[model samples]
Target: MKFKHYNQQQTVLLPYSFDDLIPEQHPVRVVDYVVESINIQPLLKAYSKEGNPGYHPKMLLKVMLYAYMTNVYSSRKIELALRENINFMWLTSMTIVDHNTINRFRSNKLKDSFKEIFKQVVLMLASEGLITLKQIYTDGTKIEAQAGRYTFVWGKSIKTNKAKMLTQLEDLWNYAQSIDNDDNPDPEPTQFKEINKEVIEQTVAKIDAKLSGNEKASSKSKAKLRYIKNNFVANLEKYEQQEAILAERNSYSKTDTEATFMRMKEDHMRNGQLKPAYNTQISTENQIIVHYTIHQNPTDTKTLKPHLENFEKTFGKETLQQLKEITADAGYGSEENYDYLQEKELTAYVKYNTFDKEQDKNYQKKNKPFSKENLYYNQEEDYYVCPMGQKMHKTHQSKRTTEAGHTQSLSHYQAKNCESCPLRGQCFKAKGNRSIERNHNLERHKQRTRELLLSETGIQKRKQRTADVEPVFAQLKHNNGFRRFSLKGLEKVELEFGLMALGHNLRKKIAA
Candidate 1:
């Protein structure tokens, strides 16, 4: 057979819209369909009545979301795709959108509506039966922020520095008064609160005028005055802000002050150097991120309550009240969490401190009766019998308080005759006697937790929670290369995570 000849410069007239350029079954079609279905009123609310015409929110949201789905997070890259990529051109209708506009829409216009929009998508998934909505699995990972690794500030460090600076301020105040021959008592602590950047500047100016005119002030006094003026007074606002963050947070980043300095596992040097990051918590079902929130807390313990609470609130009480079970790792094991789930009457497979050790027989045997698991307690008499046949009598009841001032009941128990017991070497480490403090309510709740954790259905759910949630994070970070956040501050950080989750969900929807 003869081959067809091709012309070097052949041009044919063909009529086809951008829609025809992208197939009907393409992923862009799914994005377009979903974008068309959702209510864009929230996005439109950001625009004024009329000035110059701008890109529609639906087109912008579609492009932004599609960009995230394809792992193109940068605005400039998205802008280039909008112009160069035919699929993006088809989805965005070939509209030219600048990178600044794209960034603004993501970091500004879409910030407030991130949760609402994400909730809509999740609710849609729930309605479509993609997510069960009956069970929720929450896990947190530290995502580095768009701040320098060295720009870290701990709240404790600020308080220590502040105290030293305050003492120096007092010393300088005394020296200044002595130099002026005014022997009035230095300003009180209450008066110190009134001293601001302006006050310090005025005081420094007065001292400088006196020193220049008379030159009798000591070099030490002049240096101290200059030091406080240059450093303390200049950065008073920043110091106050840092102290405020430190008062509430353990550690904060200097560049992005709201970002807490957390040790991320993806350290290149393997030394666990602190990076400014946000602790991002996400609840997943069927490998789709259903809900997510940013927390400053470095650990996952405190995030559970608020995460679940926000989950319920986002979907509404009636919609989420049916959710009766939650599964999480041992990182979220705490009495406060267990009690909260109990109070809400929701089933929780939340582990406690010793939950993992209790699972292993060898570990259990190593710390039996002393482990609280091996202690045999009499329900009627309310006393525990040690493995050595010694009765641990309840000595007293006391209230133990947490940092948040929340109180819990603790029963102090003393093992009778531990001083002369044969197993004292193995059991009792204390000199005189062995004492145990138990939170009676917490222990009872833990017993119930342990039973559920060991049950057939519970075991399956536990496995499913790990299987469902972990890969979502792994894919988000490793596959998509989303190890670090491209934004700064909590709000912007939240918005970026929201978009990523939404994109990931949309991709899942497409695959389905």
Candidate 2:
């Protein structure tokens, strides 16, 4: 094992410099081209004039887009990279911007601007034959919000807790005073060492003021105060327990009051806990995201029309008209939604509950055909025919008022007729007559459904919706680490969601 040692003198030389390492037309370089193509100078000019002195909006946007593309969401980390990482250096034009500035830009003016920029990119891709505007898939996925579910305090609960806290304080003060009197041998000494009456009175007055304000506070405002208090308490507890957990090998758990629990699927207690999030909706055509929105609404049914309307505004009238089919899962299914699609003359494959296997399986086997779709309607008779070929005559037509104070003309069918019919067991179990209530828009819904079922391409496109949309959410949660939002309120949550969608679209584009 004899070896010869010599003074280090040998050196290796590289053929190319760091600048030459990256291709001149790399996707990173295309950042500038994309920005220029979108024509964001006016936005930059506006922001610059409004107290943002030297920083260019394009530079900030490019940095953000690059961050999203790479899945580096934290503003501080992005700021650190600019001063260190070569790729970020080049992307941000070698300018080092602070994390606060980066964050402010993303959270403030950049949200709307990025939304418009996303649309422009989608349009650009469409023009380049990279995307087709004909068929689109729409879906929503819940991302955890910045606030915890526990932080959502009901007004009733807050009132109860405030009263309890006040009582506790009063009892503690009384006990402390009793202890002082018991220990005091002289009355003069006890009087001098008494608790500050002014402080107690002020605290009581403050509590009373809070209670009075609660009566005037909106439900939303009350929730916000509770959220802040919960966060404050949780943070305090976290710090107090930090030291005790430091030495233990298995007990280093911390609670984030501002973190809400959400999930991709409704599985109670899994691998790692997820937090409160928004339901992000995205509309895609030919695998490119054309329209996107983020909502605090936990459900998907309410988001369909708004997102579609936003899509129309983003792409212009001609491009919107080119959208032949809108596909969504059972979550987007509603009679109103179907009517809306029909009014727009847009084919929709919005699956109603009957289409979902879990829901269908829960129904009695014989009753499955009793679904609205399976009930044969005779256009000539203006009535429904049972599966057993028994006609359900319109017994009565009367105007009915809804809880919302809207009147509708409802035609009721004979329940007695259904009782003796062979399809009675399948159709209705009610003691009274089984009725079919038709809305004024019933025809519109039927037309929409007819169009959707008849179009071969539309049907095929609808089948592809789950494949196209669900995977986006899967990647966002499992791969991209975007299970919950880092911000609060619906608006900020929405902005965060837009960023996530932008990230997804950019990744898809790059991969394609």
Candidate 3:
């Protein structure tokens, strides 16, 4: 056997660049290419001309995105990569950026401008014929926030505590009135609107003044009054502030005030515990994330409008004009969403909650023979034929207002008689005749969706949807291990995810 001549101290005559050391088809090259192609004036504007020039935002962006693509999310690890990894060195041209600088650039500098950067990348991808922007497959997933799971503030808890305080205040006020001999009595039932520190202080002072030196008032009650005077005001103010932060959300994480507690599917314990997470909604075209939005609400139905609105705001309404259709799972199938899709003049291949069950013949025939779905409706007469062949006439109409403020008109249909009926035991669970509510407009929309979804084109789109969009999440979360956010606040987390989304697009491009 022969061994090749190798020397530890051998010096080369030629000096080659870091580019020569990297492979031509490396993903790092693609990252550099796509990032360099985008207009980074938004990122450049973050810097001031007065001070000494910092590490180029362009370089930092490339490095951060590449790091995320490779599953190195920590800033310190990225800094280490810049020093140790050959590909990273080549990408940054041997410029080693410190972790603090990297974190600052990501957390502060990229916060406002990341959306533009992401849009530019998507546009670049569009130019390359990767994404059509014709039809978008939308889906939402809950990603855990970079906060302690137990550190949560529930709006319900706040309201309950506040209610207790109100009760205590009322008792104290009534006691004060009963004991006081003054002719000028305090107003009965003080109306507390938007409880604040000032309101509590004023109420406590009045009660304390009336109760002071009164023999009828017990010492324990006096101590409680003092306690209320000392703590109730501060506690009420805190609850008020928390409710303000909560807005429409039921709960928020104390560590990350913007992060709402949501039930995530990635439950390691299998107990279905609610964790502090953000509802991440993304619209994809040809497996590339064209647009994304972070929402505090956990429900996907409420997020569609804002997500599409942001998509238009980022890319322009002209971009939405280019969209021919939008497809999503049952989570996004709401009357509000359907109406929005209709208003946008875009075709919806969305599925409602009962779509799958409606497809099952056994469900219709055996499982729910007496259910509203199995009943036959007469469009002309506005009545439904029940399982017992009874005529369920349209009795009245009602309207339901959704969280998004969209009013849904529904017609109530009730069976004329269920008493002494043979199927009464099976059908009539309530005290009176069996009734059902139907949203005509929503039913029409569902019928249209059913037609579209059952069509040949709809079948292809439906099949392609899971294959196209799901792998993006599977790759990012399961394969690449980006299940949780690294940043605390919403804006910073959005920037972080934007970087990851850009990385995903670039990686997909490289794979192609």
- Highest lDDT model number: 3
Q: After best superposition, candidate 3 residue 380: deviation in angstroms?
A: 2.8
- Which candidate leads in TM-score? 3
lDDT, candidate 1, 1-512, per-residue tens: 89898896776697568876677788778778887878777777888887998778888899988888889999999999988999998877668899999998898888877688888888788889898788888889999988878977877776677667666765665565656644564343334445466656666665565555445688877777778767986567777877777766788777888888888899978997888889999989899998898998887888888988888778888767788788888888777888888888789887777888777889866866666656888878978888787788899999888754458989988876776788878776768767788887887888898899899988998889889999999999999999988888889988998999999999999888
List candidate 2 stretches off by more than 4 Å. 1-18, 48-52, 155-268, 271-275, 356-365, 368-378, 384-391, 398-409, 415-451
lDDT of each: 0.81, 0.63, 0.88
Query: Candidate 1: minimum summed lDDT over ten consecutive residues — where?
Result: 185-194
lDDT winner between candidates 2 and 3: 3
TM-score of each: 0.87, 0.68, 0.92
State the displacement of the C-alpha of residue 266, model 3, in Å, after optimal TM-score superposition. 2.1
Write candidate 2's Cα lDDT for 327-382 as tens digits: 88878776657767877878777776545453345554644578654577766787
Q: How many residue pairs clash in each candidate?
A: 0, 11, 0
